[model samples]
Target chain A: MTALTDDTLPVTSRGMRDEMIVFVVMALLLASVPFTGVYPFFVMQALCFALLACAFNLLIGYGGLLSFGHAMFLGTAGYCSAHALKVWALPPELGILVGIAAAFVLSIITGYISIRRQGIYFSMITLALSQLLYFIYLQAPFTHGEDGIQGIPQGRMFGVLDLTKPTVLYYVVLVGFLAGFLLIFRIINSPFGEVLKSIRENEQRAISLGYRTDQYKFLAFVLSGTLAGFAGSLKVFVAQNASLTDVHWSMSGEVVLMTLVGGLGTIFGPVVGAFVIIAMQQYLASFGQWVTVIQGSIFVICVLTFRRGVIGEIAHYFRRSL
Target chain B: MQALYAQLLVGLINGSFYALLSLGLAVIFGMLNIINFAHGALYMMGAFVAYFLLNLGGINYWWALLLAPIIVGIFGMILERTMLQWLTGLDHLYGLLLTFGIALIVQGVFQNYFGSSGLPYAIPDQLKGGMNLGFMFLPIYRGWVVVFSLVVCLATWFLIEKTRLGAYLRAATENPTLVRAFGINVPRMITLTYGLGVGLAALAGVLSAPINQVRPLMGADLIIVVFAVVVIGGMGSIMGSIITGFALGVIEGLTKYFYPEASNTVVFVLMVLVLLVKPTGLTGRAA
Candidate 1:
């Protein structure tokens, strides 16, 4: 006996047509952020995390794999891009691309080894692997141990664009966010993304359908890792620093909170979740350890009662994706 | 040779804690099928509880060894009944998330009250000195910890492997629904199993308090290492966890003597090797 699907909840779109319309509207809203007069730096930082969360959502929301070590990509790319800018004198765009490339390569190897197992085992592998990386970074000379790579020059966007100015940097981050968002949108709409969702919903059936599920998972992992890296690279510029904290397990936990708060398996959820969490942290910085406690409480409450996160609940209730 | 023997002693001490922690963890996992992320937090709490008893009520370390574990066990059982019990029928990952939240909350609360700086818990007067072996002078407290934890680990292994209650626990593990149909209060057993498992951690905490400074993060890092130890040992059996814990700890300790730089990573490196050889872990059944 099939129980009632939670799909009839409000904000849930009945079909793909409405999804496209809402997607356009959301993009337009983001496009208009320049006129809002809020601090460009904060928005830039949020967008970076949002993009990283969206990329993370691609795997968990669509592929049903919860990676606990995703911050590896974020931190790796941030460190890589920062190093490139500082040591190689590469401009922002090229440096960020290089960072993404490095993460993409690392994800391929990590994804390959990790995909050999599933579920809890998969999570453990990633966590342990990243922890291993964390130690390596802590010791590696370029990282400067605990102090991290700091005060890297905010190189100009190309030769003509001035990144030192806050407004210009804001647009750079905004564009990066939009590009990453659209890329996620494109992938989800594409055939590859559909197969991924099908696999997530029922892996056995997908395998029976002759789809190379492992390859798809590997590709998805790389894509997710690459985008996460790009976001991290962008964040280095926004925050003007890269540190061990970015790659720590806690950072990975924060991303999970973001994706969950926004809405897993829903577009636009990560953005909403990122802003809410980031704003919460910004205000609650003085509380120190309480932030962790509150975040944990939210995790428990959401998993137990909410089940559906903010955007997920809203989408489920209204019968449309916002 | 002398340095190697001393490093081995250090490794064994580390291993004793690992063995005890992993043994408890394996027991809980065997019954609950939920990885208790709060395990480290409970271990920390066990020590803190003892510390509190000593500082606040003037209860000494000896009394703490007796009382702290029971208190932690009862607390753990309550958690199992209240929160963890609900998540049972769902995905194993959900249980992990719930417990992780619990771990965060417990650690956060303790950190709030005590801050990050660790408090020292002194060794009892009974276990104050060291034995000067021909090769190595072993601290009495360290030797006591290794032997005491070994006794605890072996006793637990015997309970599960030889006794009747453990039989019920194991039978429930194989098929809880069937065990429940047989009129066994499987739910209560599961809850108690978690408590017992956590009690084991608390005992380790009490044992370890004197050796390692009691801190909010004491068990955080240690748990991760224990996880690697568990993976390496393969949680297929309680004996497996114990053997792997001690063996790996000694290996790590020896690594510290021979090639100190690789000491931090020797365990992880071994884990990678184990995965390559048998992805299920050295003693773990293939999932």
Candidate 2:
């Protein structure tokens, strides 16, 4: 019985020490970016998306739940944060807190409705629920319909470290991304993470093992949503606006694309994927709608030929878990 | 009362399209096990194809209806043989992703050429004008659309439910390997089934061209609602999709008359309620 479980469930491939070394190297490279003269704005935007993608990966990669409406969390948090800062005249940290709270509530409601179904049905349900929110936001007065909430104040954190300074803001965003990333990493290696992985690998077996699988999945959903919301709150500082674009189905698709291109279940894959996609969008902005076509083509190529993704292929060849 | 009747009629017309589209989805899902995310794009393509035939080829409405589905159906078959078929035996999510990519490509190409604005397709000479049903004035084209879509939907239902060919299709769905053991061409049937389903979506597109106008992203948001309908009604039964589609459309129309503000969201709210009550959907068996 133990052999069956061992063979069926993925073996913890690489040593924790190896992962730690890679994490340290990654953190060092990212921390030194302000001194390297690379564009801080682009990195900041990518970091927000990377955090969002990592939060998304925690559910799909480890928990085996694919939410097609994660944009709801991201968009909800961004809108709330923008409102808090701009309209309510709250500080940056409080704005982020309000956003996180909104996302927390939204996740509970959406998760309750969506988690009842499994597989494709779950995805469709989440999508429908998000679209419902989209319509509400479009009509609701506070969202300002298509105009969105704009010109949010990038105030100081803790009454110091002015967010108006590019270098300071970049580090803050980087720190936020790292905090979210480490939290996700910790969750994945925990005993709870193993149980979540077992559920993903085989839900029936997990149930047979007497685990209340639904509660675990629900908890995972809330954690992922709240973290994604945190990324959204951070993004408001960078983008300075919360718009309908964040809530659109296409945004949800972009998150999926990022996670897939990096490595669906891999740790570093989402970060790499987010940077690659954001950079492509920035450079290929001149192509107009052709960019969409290209992104779509990338999706097709990934699903068909490059199913392992960029990081997945690298890890597979190196025979080390990234 | 007259306004209510008119809205109800409008709702039924919308219901007809929903029924046709969701019916097609159910058929495709049964055979392919993939939710065709590109269904909406192909539906939009059908309208575009009709427009092209009328403007360039000088084919009228009736002929365009017959030709568009066949042409787009052929394209869907090519997609199946080329890209989608390669994903056999993989996770269902890959199919959803691949089709989503196809949707974006098709919609993006159309957006590039046509821009984001709507192109008006005039109603054919025969479909113009209206009739007095004693209660309300009914547009002749709208009336024709309802009657024709009902006929097409039921005909599809008959084709799938009460035919020898459908039996083979159902058998294959149940056990493709066992059906293959009997020497039937199961793969060809799968392709044809996809073609048939896509053809149904194109047919709905053709029917709605005059009413909704031809637009690149017309089907984008609409497909999400249909997915909700599928989730609520379940893809297990063909008749279930038909009834649920029409029922939701009618309910939405009633909401439009009763509370205009909530009109856009009534279906989704209902979907959440249904999911809460029955996780397996109204007609779905446990998967």
Candidate 3:
């Protein structure tokens, strides 16, 4: 699962230009969403998930660490951000920071324990740890148990940009998603990203080259988790609630599906995948549980036939790393 | 004292399920190199199969016990033959993803029909009463579940550790090419091994139905806990999973008595502690 062909493609200057072009095109398309009047709420929710999937892609797609419990970060961040905004009366910016900081600490602690192992064990360990948190949040008073921290206040950012306004919130979420996407994009192309990819491809070889592979993997895990937390914080503003649904293992699976559907290693794939899945859910909302069945079928199909994903296939056909 | 004994019994019963499920996981992992994420869903399917048999077919508990595993085992073999077989030689993660998809589909379809509620499965006539021991009153069906699960687990162990076929299975696990060179059909063995593991899970589901009630998502959360047990026990040996599963269940039961709040989290806590102390697990060799 970690060994996708796109990760191995040589990063020439032309490939970099192609990715930049796709990123700009994607940004413009998202920025013009409000004007197109295609339901700002749906796009905002999808943007949040797109960021989450991108954060997830940073780990599994590049770092070769598949943390099955990525939802823990998202849940923790949302809960914290919700509590901060609602209970503490913190501004939107501070609430988001609180969420990010909590996720940062959580990822560090979890990464320390989980990164000790690699491959499947890493996935299981992270999963177990996340379940541990899920139970904690279930019992914790701040989360209000099953009711969750609902009706969170979407306070103005710096007392200027009002988050309660839908259009303003959408742009804020869009900008947050873009910043996170670019950060991940930059990280993947950096020298450190190269080392992380090497560790993914062959950890022993990377270690032989004096890379201190564990630290590199640990850093990648932390970054991916924190960014996932950022997405969660952004999500609380959009959803106006923090609930168990975000933290559930099923949500983790959904992020994985999105990445797989969009193409794991492709820069633009998660963005497209996020839209595709969230749109599927929005359109198929009446089908209820069948959505899960459909998503599962997608997972099976992706693994069996569409392993390269939509973006992956397109990039492969064009011989470009979009 | 009575309450403690009761919780201990409850823990023992849970330990039985955990041991059965994790033991099957270890066996399948050894053969297939895939961590059978669908094991939980298959276990749930077993309970549902028993429900369907009793409610629809009017089959008795005893027959359901005999048939649920076989039926679910065949379903598992088909799954292995049709879907899981293609995952050979890919990254282990792909197998996990594929099986996870299977689980979601199975559980989702069941939930669609069952509505996420628990459906009752009555204890069989012979095991409807309770016996008062010196320490505690033991429900006969609960006792049956524990004892029967122990017997099944042990029989599985004996079959795998002591028999000729077991040697071939173990040898194939070590090197499928060499085992195939010795005239054993390796792929067939892989399918049968999957069936056996899945059958064990289904059997656990059957045992759990009367006590826990049949539910669509029954195995969903339980699988996560079993994964913790697997990590703590290290999935290295058969006995390791059994002992760890039971021990953790007992510990969880004790926690429910002493600190009810911690009962849900104790296994995961122990997994972390184990990883910190011995990353390879108690009886596991290095991964």
lDDT of candidates 1 onward, in order: 0.85, 0.91, 0.92
Worst ten-residue run, lDDT, model 1 chain B? B87-96
DockQ of each: 0.49, 0.59, 0.71
Ten contiguous residues minimizing lDDT sum, candidate 3 chain B: B278-287
Candidate 1: chain B TM-score against the reference chain B: 0.97
Q: Arrange candidates by TM-score, highest first: which order?
A: 3, 2, 1
Question: How do these models rank on lDDT, best leading?
Answer: 3, 2, 1
lDDT of 2 at A256: 92
TM-score result, candidate 2: 0.98
Lowest summed-lDDT stretch of 10 residues in model 3 chain A?
A: A5-14
Candidate 3, B132: how far from true, in Å? Answer: 1.0
What lDDT does candidate 2 reach at residue B179? 98
Cα lDDT for residue B264, candidate 3: 95
Model 3, TM vs. native: 0.98
List CA RMSD, all candidates: 2.3, 2.2, 1.4
In order of DockQ, best first, we have 3, 2, 1
